[model samples]
Target: MIEHTALVVGGTSGIGLATARLLQQRGATVHVVGRTERKLDPELIPHWADGGDPAQIAAVVAKAGPIDWLVVSLSGGEGAGPIAGLDVATLRRAFDAKFWAHLTTVRAALPHLTPTGSITLIGAISARAAMPGTAGLAAINGAVEALVKPLAAELAPIRVNGVSPGLVDTPWWSGFPAEARAAYFAQMAERLPTRRVATAEDVAEVVALAATNPNLTATVIEADGGARLAALV
Candidate 1:
């Protein structure tokens, strides 16, 4: 019943990879597009591209025809810090990666989506929760979240939704040393209501739900371990 062709942008690693594999398990044939194909699920069809490039995205989606689901998890992290000390280059990179790139991909894939097609954009808890040092993330993620409702309405039969996760432990933190990452996770665990960090698979499950459910649209579901609630306190 889950049989369809799915294109998962940023499917090389982390939540994207997890979602790619999950789709396979549910009986969908999945094509994964990303900059690095090295970490992709072997069962997935791999296509390489820098997700920030509109030309590349257009080319890639052109080949993955008649897609039933479009999952865009493409992202970039400009290191967190005070807003006053923000680096312009890093901020621009963040916007290019998280916001503008998504816009490009969505437009390219829209024509190819099947009549019952669905799109799930990977967002973040930063959109709703304000924590110090995540100003850039908040801005980009919030913009994407804001676009969901309008897209769902305009796209009409083509459902659009968002999956927002918090403090996920993924290759994104590879820049940090092992112990430092552990310390950060431990710190987050104490504050989050779930008392634990989210795994890529955890968020991927929700992507599957949002993509498969016919009625769920124009909504941003939180897959965070209660991160937004903590911010309110």
Candidate 2:
């Protein structure tokens, strides 16, 4: 059991919250930080700050005190369309949310990280999968994955890893119409070799593994239900 403190930025919902719960189960004291309005758990301590803002993230790092683990799980922009039609505003917002947030949070939290601490960034399968309408997301995910190596090297013993998930059933898809969302999930389930979409718990398990494993650093763990293999078939 991990008997240390962990901070999960963007932990109010979705994968972030799931990872927090998992870490808590493993015996870590979890402090959750949400950028905007969020329903916080009573059992876990709460901190509020925008992940994209360095000042805000630094404040959260200070408020949380020392941390043995830090997970950055900010979601991407919602307005992604085709590359030609995608506006600069949308792309900028996506970058701020997905890319800047991870960097800013890590920069702020690095000082407070314990000697054996781990840092896990939530990435996406878009980094590898060549799907339509994910141009912006793919770029952001790629950046997150790219940082693993340099970050791990710079942080030394503090491991830096990523959990790249594909088509997880999370609130990220809840904005779509119920029927459409269900259909999309079904389509992905049929296409993936695993015959099912990922759950938040599925990604969370990998996040936990990355955080605890001594030998793992600068690695991007793919939790995509064999999407790559399915794409070939």
* TM-score, every prediction: 0.96, 0.95
User: In terms of lDDT, which candidate is strongest?
Assistant: 1
Q: Give Cα-based local distance difference scores for all models.
A: 0.89, 0.86
How would you encode candidate 2's per-residue C-alpha lDDT over 13-81 as one tens digit per residue? 888899899888778899998867777767678888898888988988998868988999987645356
The global Cα lDDT (0 to 1) of model 1 is 0.89
Off by over 4 Å in 1: 231-233
Return the clash pairs for model 1, or none. Answer: none
Tell me the tens digit of each residue's lDDT in model 1 across 1-233.
44799999989889999999999988898999988649555689999987778789888888997899999999986736789999988898889988888898999898899989999998898887888878888898998888899999999899999999988999999999999999988987998899999999999999999988898999999999889889533
The global Cα lDDT (0 to 1) of model 2 is: 0.86
